[model samples]
Target chain A: MTGYTAKKAGYAIEYIALIAVVLIVWCVMAGRGTLNEIIMPAPSKVLDTVTELIGSGVLWTNLVISVVRVLKGYFIAVVLGVSLGILIGLSKHAERLSVLIIQIIKPIPPIAWIPLVILWFGIGESGKVFLIFLGSFFNILINVHDGIKQADEKYIEVSKSMETPFFKHIFRLIIPGAAPNIFTGLRIGLSSGWMCVVAAELVSSTTGLGYMIMNARQFGQTDVVIVGMLTIGIIGKLMDSLLRAVEKRAIKWNWSE
Target chain B: MEHKYIEIKGLSKIFTRKKESVHALENIDFSVDRGELVCILGPSGCGKSTLLRAICGLDTEHSGDVFIDGRKVIKPEKTRGMVFQEHRLFPWLTVEENVAFALNGVDKDTKAELVQQHIDLVGLTGFEKSYPRQLSGGMAQRAGIARALVNDPELLLLDEPFGALDTFTKMAMQKELKQIRKKSNTTMIMVTHDIDEAVFLADRIIVMSPRPGSIVKVIDVDLAEPRDRNSYEFLEIRKEVFNEF
Candidate 1:
């Protein structure tokens, strides 16, 4: 469970220096009273706001809502994307037909769908999730397609020599071979999912970390905005680390072998 | 009047890459009797591996016929199991799982029993749960052999099975292969560039030369079983096979 436990002195120095620089800038600005309070709240004030939100159970509720929204969208995107991606990757006809459509739709930013999503689903949880799904689905699809397409021809020949059927070859050989790429797709999908959640909440939601930040901005509660932003960054980092741990166990052979 | 277990007549292969054509094999012909162990000996790029692929039905883009028993080989069948130069054991699967890979439709009890038996045959009984990455080069090749044998194939095709191993390990593996062949008595055809290996294991060695590879000689090893490297007969056969180079 202890991952990357060997700490290098150079890396440690870099991390400490980064934090020290941020702290010095914050302290100098607060002490000199150069920036207005509404624009750049004191770090201490932001920390105090975080504790207050935690004590009142507000932060927990927003965090859960945002997490639930992201999970819903991400799960749906993975299931549909992986299935269709495999289909399109294996079949020449499917690739020919879908490549143009996928290319046209994939490059459009997830936030650009906000107007349509809101118009179709209203400002409910479904609309927010739809936006997030749009954010993640295409990236996951493309990665999975590439993964299946790029499976080692040698392994495929192994399956062929075994008289393995097409479906069996795909499930037994291709999917597993494509796993490393699929994991990469999942990680990218997650960050994109998070981005969509915040963007969607910014425009229409009333009860997420993004909504909290936007709502606090209206009330000139700059400390609360900083707290919300910091919470998002911390959560994203934690999720990525957790994913890295799982990936290490799953693809350990890739490293040592 | 005599039955040939495997028959190849006028087999030829030409590959095209980037609008350039290269002849891999030309007008090759050979046959092996049932239960015989044969080795195709050649230098690198001499079409020995290509011949094995054609026999195993992995490459059909050739001009000729390969008959296993009385039937023309068309597509790959479970009857012909193959092991590549590298221990192509799937990284995701454990040793046991890799051996059981071909027994997809078998009953669970039968599958486990067969897997265990083959694992034991390859001297990997204790490492069944280990992944291919955890194994040594020889151990992984043993696992590959076990995987190929788990299906009880009529013919086991090996493409330079010990080419990647260190000298000592390769010698040890060659000895174990003899024992395995004696125990199972399954027909096998191995491709190799090593003349010593060809003399050590083959009942008959088909010597080939490169550049549109064609057979130059077919040397039958008449040495006794448990072949000794220092024996006069062994040296004579080795010298004879090397002379074809």
Candidate 2:
């Protein structure tokens, strides 16, 4: 246990070391006026902008708005994607009917939908949520379908021999068996949703970190732009870590084996 | 004529892939008396596992009839339980949960009791909470057996239950299986490629040949309890079964 902890601490030190080096270089360059403040503000300037945003409640308000939008889209994607996946997975007819349509729509990037989204929903939250939904839905659907298909036939045979009830068979055997893959889809779908929300906000939204970054760019507040980018990176990482933690707990058997 | 506990008649299976048909089993017929332990011994690709699957109703594509307690088997039922070559335990479930998997309609206490009883029967008492990955191959197979027996099935079908184990573990498991059979008196039909395993556990051994698998011989083992593998009688029976191959 001690050795494991020491190894983990070593990795943490390495991660922080690289970031510290980059920050020191940036600070030195900006202090020496080698870098223009408009283009690349000093770390201190960005820190001040962060503090100012926080004091004025702009950071928290926009952060809440972005998070709520992501949650709405992600929730919808998960519900529809997993249900549709299960439907297609269990029925040969459903799979055959939907495969071609899903394939055609899946390849078109979520970014490509921005023009149509604007034409339909304008710059409202609905369009942004729809864009995020599109980004995440297919990833989850495809993965869940694959996961169900890949469940071992042997286990199914055992379930059959036991005469497990139809609903019980699906819930106890098939779902748990496909859980690892479903979790993979969920994690990937979440990240994709995060990316799409930012892109949508960038293209048309009046709020969110993406809009904050764009608005700062126009006003030449490079410090605020830098802060917005940093916020997105940190929050994205945090969300991923949260999901990973849940995945680790829920499927401990996968890790041990 | 006395009604057999289990019966198979004119069982045949053919697999067609891309217009090429492979005959797996041809005119296979057999039966097991109540509380009797029968082993179907054969070489690989001899349809021993296929026959076991057909008996358990896991393979209903076969053109034939299987009757257990005078009832035709159209699909798998709780009255018949099966253990496969691999343990096939649910990776997500603990030993206790896997044992209790097929059990429903019973009260929670009864369910727990049955799960506990079967776990102890298989000598997996302490590892009830442990997942399949945490157990060794033999232990996992033991859990599989417990799960199969939890339903208290009248007939237990095992297709190479210990085939994946090392020689020592296989021998030990065979002994445990014998003890289990003695205690439960459940009708067991085991399919095995190992000659010694058949000799060790089976009351009657049905030997088969590959390439349209057909029963070549049926040899009854009348050895006394705690039969010695190295004894002359055991060797004689082993030799007789081996010669048929």
Candidate 3:
């Protein structure tokens, strides 16, 4: 039961800094002039923007669209990453072929290909998803590759000594044995997928939180910008928490061992 | 013995690494009789482990064949079970699951029964649900034994199984092994450096020579069952095995 004790330092410092910043902003703005709509919309107004967007169903629709893009891009990345990872991780030939190619491609920013994506996929959901895929694919591929490469040789020896059949050995022993590393890849891929989605929407969509921020900038709706930013941060943090929870539950059996 | 369960004839293993050939085991001929407990004892680097590993078909480049009941063993199978020096239980699996791993294709009812039977046989009935990390070293080794014995192998091969345990635990396990062998009558081969352990557990002990290991001597234990370890005869035999060192 006591395993759930929260770490005090990181969260406490972050919360304290945020609170101090908000208090300073509020005090300075209130003392400087009467409450106004334009110059620095009160923090309360930003929160009100969130509720209004939620009540009107605008928030839900845009959130779903962004989520769908992340899912499609991330799912494709996982399939490609796992297969490629296993290949490169297991075989010297595959690793040699990919080592240089991955290095060349990995350093290029996913957003830098926005112009190329626009030319190929155009201004649609496809363009946004492709961008997201570029961001997430390499992260997953590298982790999966590392996992497979480092699988315990002793276990493999054991299975080989038993004459464990080929397919069963690969599927039951190799894959699951490398699962912890695969999970690390998954968490990295999913989070980076979100970063790509935001950049994708900014380049293409008229909907999503990224588009909302762009629109708010045009109309000088500073409060809406804050709401959009907060939504992105909160959702990213929540998704990370969800992934950690799933990982813990899945690996609990290993705790004793 | 004419009724030997296993016969290793003219066995030799060499490893070619970077075009440099290393002789691991020389042309060796040794045999084990049915229902006998045999131990291979030698100093470090004498290839005691290499010879044992070759018998289990762990060495692909080895010459000669290991025959069990008139059949050659080209690879490991349910007929031959092996226990390693480090109780290699899968951390992700519980005791029951680890024991059942070898019977991957067995029917569900039979699998369940065999798993439970082996767990009890190893004196780990209450710890079936525990993982390898949760158990003490002795308990984990017992579980490893259960996993090896679950399939009812014709022969059991142990590679320094109790070398990692403390003296007290090792002695207790030695007694347990004797009891289990008496009840099951399974032919057993063990590799160890302990002279006392060899005398206490083995019906015969094969001592190996230096590099390109071959059998130097095979000492027979003529002492009767439930043999007194403190007796002068037992100590004498134990000393003879140690003298080979």
Candidate 4:
């Protein structure tokens, strides 16, 4: 709670400074606002577009569609990544078998999967989710593996002395020990979730924040484009904050030292 | 006289590294009485810790039998509670939880009461919820001792339990240990290199020789209860154990 308050205080101060800078820039521009609205839109104009979209309920509809797809894809990615990472960590044979394949595949960016996802799943929800899953899986897997590898030897020895069951040892000690790293992976994966969803929408969707931006661009609605971009940023931040809250709860022992 | 609770007969351990054999312990035969507090003193790399580890059944490649209660120890169990040098309390758990961790598959009420009792036994009543990191060096060691004793094992194996502590803390711990032994009549075998620590705490100080280790001499401490370290008798015994090195 204290950390959140301190961060909020810092964000508020930054916003105040940002508003001051924008005001100075506005004065320098001196109302010579060109009708060339393709590249940049006025902040007030973007806000008005956001309000109009919200009032008409198109914003809610698009937001829900995008959020649902990202959630589904991101969760699948998290489960696969974490479980496979753990198996690889615990078993040397599994590690030797899969590490080379993972190294070869991880380099191919999630965006590059768009062509294949379209071919495999058609230009629909399935294609977009596959793209989002691809974006998140590798990062989460690597983090979980690293976290397990980094666990202290002494803790393992303690469990060994007690003769704790293999699964209990992993769940009770290894998982908790690797939690901070996994949380970091989740944060990164979730951001990738938004990017892949947006990219997917642009590639094949009729409705979504990405499609909203694309639709606005066709009509030269610069303010609506800015609104869609800002909404994406805000929603992405909310998901991250929610994950952080869960992380805090899980690793509450790490509150101070 | 009671038969020795622990009897090591020709115990030897040879470690093979790249086809080169290293002799860790060689032809060691030692015995301890049922109520004896025996502290083994030796130099670093002298296999003192290895001996303790072997007796605790963590080092299985070692030869010969380490008979505990006339039975060979093959693996660590609740029967022998060990207090390690570094106070290896689990970081995720508080003092109470760490102490009670080994008493699993028991009723909750019994576990809770035992946990609280042991926490109080080690003078950690107030620090029940404090994590290992939150504790001072001395306090953590005390918690470690408490954790070992909470099991109420037949043998308490201490591997340089207070070696990491400062001189003052070490003295205080020795005194606390004496009081605990007196109160409970617990059988303990501590491994330490400090001659003074051995003389001060042990009923019999088992002086161990350097590498390919073996018991050189067993100096009995015959001084009265609440031992006076400065007394002539204690000093004489200390000198005898020192000479065995």
Candidate 5:
């Protein structure tokens, strides 16, 4: 227990040191006037701008909108990707049927579809959600596919010889076996979805963290831009840590000691 | 002979890769009586594992018939439980969950009762909630046995179940397995490369030869229950079995 506490303390210290270094660099750059405030606002000014945005309810509304968008797209992507991935992964016929199409579409960047999405959905929630869905879906599908493929053949045989029903075998043996990799895909998919939401909002949406950053850039409010960027970073980090905690609980058998 | 519970007739398995075909089994025939323990013993690559797979209906491409209780074996059934060389327990599931894997339609209360009974039967009573990775190899295999037996299978097929265990654990597991078999009175068909294991556990040993594998000999042991492994009688039988190799 003492060793565990010391290790946790070490981690806290390391993070504190990193924050201190960033603060020092920001202070030095601001105080020396080495870079223009328009491009690199002082940390204090950014914090003040963040306070103003929150006071006016702009920051919270935009953050919530961005989060909602991400949730909608990510939820759909997970459902589609995992189901299709399992289908393709389990059967040679299913894989062969979709392999060509998947290979063709997966390589095309989500940004590449921005014009088409805007044309179809007319800069609405659907368009932005579609873009984020595209960004996350392929990553999830590929990882889930590989994860199911990586399931031990011996276990599959055991399930088979036990006369386990097809769906039961998948639920009991294959899915749990592929969980770690699926979690990997989910983490990657979430971050990519977050990226796509920002990109979509920048391109078309009227209100979101991305829109705030872009609107601030138009008015030369560098502080607000910095605040928006930092908010996105902070939220992303929080989501990742949340996922890590969940994975720790879900994959309890991974403790190999 | 006692009533035949499992019958394999003219079984043959051929493997083809890159236009080259290798025969894994050829014209093999065998029968296991009810409540009897039969071990298919051979060197590596002698189709022992393949034969077990075929009998359990996991390998259906073989060109013969396997009948269990007068019904043709086309696919694996709930009555035939199999244990592979590896423990093959689902890592995500606890011991109790793994044992309850095949009992899909069973009620929660009955499932719990039967799973607990099987876990105790396999001497894994206290570690019911432990994950597969947390257990030792022998313990994991015991969990595997409990999982197989929880469904109350008529025939338990084991392929080198204790092969990964240490010597001491292997011997202990063998004894535990014998006890479980005796208690359940389930027909067992085991495959092993260990001659002593076959002799110690089996009522009859089927010695197999490789390269288009076929049964070379059938040695029946009239030894009594709890046969002493180091006794003179056991040694004589062991030597007689070893001489066939």
Candidate 6:
């Protein structure tokens, strides 16, 4: 137990060391006037801006909006992606019919769809949600499809020998077999969704961290911009950590090594 | 005429890969009596595994008929159970869950009771909640056995089930398998490369040769219970089997 705790402490130190060094360098550079305050603000100034935003309730409001958008889009992507993935994965006919279209659309970046999305849905919540969905959907679909396709033939045989019912076979063998890959998809899809929401906000929005960063930049409030960027980073990490925690519990068998 | 419990007539498997066709098994004929432990012993690449798969109805492309208990084998059924060389236990499930994998339609209490009985049968009672990865190779294979037996299969097909274990563990598993067979009275067909394993476990050994696998010999083991490996009759039988190779 002590050894485990020590190892955890070691990791914590490693994580903090780089951030501390970067912060010290930023403080020194800004204090010495070696860096332009307009372009790169001191760590202390960014911290002060964070305090100001939090005090005014601006941070919480925008954070909630961005989080809601991400959740909405991510939920849709997961439901559709997993269902479609299983469909395609199980049926060769479905795979053959959809493969070419999926391949053609997959390579195109979500940012490339911004103009088309704006034209279709305008600069409203729908447009942003649509953009986020596009960004996350393909990642999830491909991963889930791959997961199902890679379901162990041996396990399938076991289920077959048992004469497992159709739905039981799918739920017990195929889905669980594809779980690790599905989790991978969810993680990547989530990160991509987060990125899409920020990009959409940046392109056309009056709220969200991306808008805050852009607005702050126009006024040369580099501290607020930095604060916005930091908020995005911190929130992204937190969300990923939350996912990882759930993953650890869901697939504890995978973590034996 | 007394019908055999399991019969394989003129079984042949040809694999058509790309442009070339390879003969895997050729005109394999065999019959296993009810509650008999039969082992198909052969060298590697002799299609013994393929033969087991055919009997298990996992391979339907073979050109022949396998009748089990007067019914024609079409596809896999709950009455037929198979254990592969690898434990092949689902890594996501605990030992208890793995054992209970095939008991889907049973009520919760019955399922749990059956799972508990099989776990105890396999000497894995204490480690029911442990995942496959957490168990040793032998333990995992025991769980695989438990899983196969959970459905009360009338026929159990094992393809090199203990071929991956160390010699000592293999011997111990062989003994455990004998006890299991005695208790269940289920007809068993095991494929193995180990001659001693066949000699120890099989009521009759069907030895095969590679390059389009075909049965070369049918040797009945008339030895009594707890057959000793070092005994004179055992060595004589072992030598006879080895000489056939």
Which candidate leads the pack in TM-score? 6
- Writing each residue's lDDT as its tens digit, candidate 4 over A158-244 gives 666666676778887888888898898888988987877778886768988889989988998888887888899889989899999
In model 1 chain B, which range of ten residues has the least summed lDDT?
B97-106
lDDT of 2: 0.90
Task: Give residue B5's lDDT in candidate 6 (0 to 100).
Answer: 84
Model 2 residue B232 distance off true place after TM-score fit, in angstroms = 1.8
Candidate 6: residue B245 lDDT (0-100): 90
True contacts kept of 3: 0.36
lDDT of 6 by residue, A1-257 (tens): 69999999999999999989988888888889888777777777788888999999998888888989988999999999989998999999999999999999988887888889888988889888888888889999999999999999989888888888999889978999898999999999998899887777855899987788788889988888778887888888888899988988898888966
For candidate 2, state the interface root-mean-square deviation in angstroms to 1 decimal.
Answer: 0.8
Per residue, candidate 3 scores C-alpha lDDT tens digits across A1-257 of: 24344555556777789879977888678667766768678766766888999999887888888888888999999999989998898789989988999999999988889899899988988888888888889999999888887878877766765667777777767777778888888898889988777798977579988888888899999888878877777777788788878877776654442
Cα lDDT for residue A250, candidate 6: 92
Q: Model 5 clash pairs?
A: none
Per-model TM-score, in order, reads: 0.94, 0.93, 0.86, 0.86, 0.91, 0.95
Task: Provide the clashing-pair count of each candidate structure.
Answer: 0, 0, 0, 0, 0, 0
Summarize candidate 4's per-residue lDDT along B1-245 as a digit string, tens digits: 44578988888988788999878888888988887898988987778888988888877778898988888888877677788889988777789888887676779999999889888877888999998889999999999888888778778889999988899999999999988887678888999999999988988877788667777777888878778889998899888887775
The number of residue pairs in model 2 that clash at the backbone is 0
Task: Report the C-alpha displacement of residue B209, candidate 5, in angstroms.
Answer: 2.7
Per-model DockQ against the true two-chain complex: 0.58, 0.83, 0.42, 0.42, 0.69, 0.84
- Computed on C-alpha atoms, the DockQ of candidate 3 is 0.42
Clashing residue pairs found in predicted model 4: none
Which whole-number lDDT from 0 to 100 does residue B198 have in model 6? 96
What CAPRI class is candidate 5? Answer: medium
Colliding pairs, model 2: none
Candidate number with the higher TM-score (2 or 6): 6
Largest DockQ belongs to which candidate?
A: 6
Candidate 4 docking: what grade? acceptable
Candidate 2 local lDDT, A1-257, one digit each (tens):
69999999999999899999999999999889999878888888889889999999998888888888888999999999999998898889999999999999999998899899989997788998998999999999999999989989989888888878889998998988989889989989998998886787965778888788889889988888888888888888898899999999998988864
Residue A149's lDDT within candidate 5 is 89
Q: What interface RMSD does each of the candidate structures achieve?
A: 1.5, 0.8, 1.9, 1.9, 1.1, 0.9
Candidates 2 and 5 compared: the better one by DockQ is: 2
